[model samples]
Target: MIKSWLKEMEAEYRIEILFASETGSRAWGGATVHSDYDVRFIYKHHDVRSYLSLRKAQETMDFPAPYDAQGWDIYKAFHLLQKSNPGLCEWAFSPILYHDCQNFSSKLRRFVTESYSLISLFHHYIHLMDRNLKDIRGKAFTEKRQKQFIQAVRAFLLAKAIILEQKVPVMALYSSFSSSFPKDCTIVSFYQQLMEAKQSGELVSYADIEDAIFMMEQERPLLLELSYGLSKGKSIENELNQWIWELLHL
Candidate 1:
C-alpha cells in the first residue's frame, strides 16, 4: 500500500523520491496498535529553472487519509539540515524505512550528527515536552488521557539526554535512555513498566509522574545553561547545496 502510494505520488508530482521512512511514534518504537503510519519522504525535481526564480517552488507535499504521506523537497530538507532541524534528523535516523537510497540516507545520517547543534536539538525536544505537558495541564490524569503524558516523558527524556551527552538523542526511546542514563534509575524503571503496559494494551495513567517530573525539573536548568554556552557549529549549506546539485543531475 505504501509503495503504491509513493508511486502514485511520484507520478502525480513529477518528482523522484530519494528517501522515505516512517516517523513519529512508530519510528520511535513506542506506537500502540491504533497508531497511524506517519510516512515522510524527501524528493527532488530535475528542472533547474524552477528553483532560480524569486518565488520559491513548493517545498512540501502532503496526501490525506488512512496513511499520512508527506514530503519535503530535497532543497528545503537540506536548508533545514543547515539549521540542525530535529525533525529532519529524526527522519534520517528512523528505524523503519519504506524506501531509501543507501548512499543518500547514509550520507545524510553522517552529516546530521556532525553538523547538528546540540543546543538547537535540545531546545527542540524541550519545546515538544512543554507542548505535550500543556495539553494535559490542570486536567485529571486518567488512563485514557495518558497519551500526552507519555509524549511529554519521551520529549523530556530526549531533551535531558541531548543536554547531558552533548549529542543528538537516539530516536528509539529505550535505546536513548539506556545509552545516556543509568540502568537502575527510577525513570528508566518507570519507562520500562510503561512500555510493558503499552504493549499489553493496558491503560497508562499519570499515577507515576512524580519521578518523571522531578527529573525534568532537575535537568531543565542544565539544558538552558548549556544552550547558552555551546556554540552552533558551521552551517552545512555548502555541502548540502553540492549534494542537492548531484541529486538533481543524477
Candidate 2:
C-alpha cells in the first residue's frame, strides 16, 4: 500500500526527496508503544508552473488518512532543494520510506548526501529551540521537556552541520556533532532549566518551566539573521522533469 501510494504520487508530481520519519525503529530506542507514522515528501516542478511566486499560498499539499495514524506532506520540490533545507535531510533517512521513484528523489538523496546549508539549518534549530523553551519556560500547557530536549539536540547538530560539513546533515544526529553548538540567551536558558529539572528530579510537567519558555519567546527574533535566503537550494536538472513527464504519460 505504501509503495503503490508513493508510485502514484510520483506519477502525479516530480518527487525530488521523499523522507519518512517517526515510523518507529527499534534501534532508535522506541519502545513497543504504538507510534504514528509521519511521512513527509518534497517534490519539484519541471515546468514553468513552479515559479508562481506564491510559495506559501498553498503551493503544497498535506493530508492524513487511511492508516493506523499517518501523515502526508507534499511540498513544492524546488522550494526546498535550494539552500539544503534540513527537512530534506531529515526525511531522506526516516528509517521508514515506502518508495522513491522518478529518479529526481534519488538524486536529491545523493545531493543531500553531499551538501546542506548550515545557516538555514541553524535558523531552523533556533526556531525549534525557541519553541522548546516556550514549552519548558512559558505557557506550554503540556509537559514538553522531552520534545525540548529533542529540539536542543537537533539545534546542536544543525550548528555542527555548518561547522563541520558546511551544510545540513541528515536528521539522525551523529556523535560527530553531539557535543556543542553556538548558544544564545534562549539556548542558555533552556540548558539552565534542563539542569534545574535534573537536579530537582521533579516531574517534567512542573510549572516552574514557564520562565524558560517565556525567555525563548522573547528571544525568537534573534535567529532571523541566520535563516535568510536559506531556501534557494540547487537548481533542478531538466531531465528530472522529463522523467516526471514520462511517468505521467505526457
RMSD of each: 2.3, 7.8
Candidate that would win on lDDT? 1
How many clashes show up in model 1?
0
List candidate 1 stretches off by more than 4 Å. Answer: 53-55, 142-144, 171-176
Q: What is the lDDT of candidate 1?
A: 0.76
Which predicted model would earn the best TM-score? 1
lDDT per residue for candidate 1 within 1-250, as digits (tens), equals 8888888888887878889988866776667888789999998865677778898877999876758878999878988889898888888988888888756789988898888888788788888888877777668876555666777777777877776666676544335366567778676667667666765777655556655776777877877887775547568877887887788674
Candidate 2, residue 59: lDDT: 53
User: Distance (Å) between predicted and true CA of 243, model 2?
Assistant: 6.4
lDDT of each: 0.76, 0.48
Collision pairs in model 1? none
Candidate 2 local lDDT, 1-250, one digit each (tens): 7556655665776543344344332223322344344556554444445444665323555547543323232344444554455655655545555555544456666666555555656667676665655555434344246545545544544553454444455543432222444455344445444544434443444443445445444544544544553543454545446544554446
For candidate 1, the per-residue lDDT at 57 reads: 78
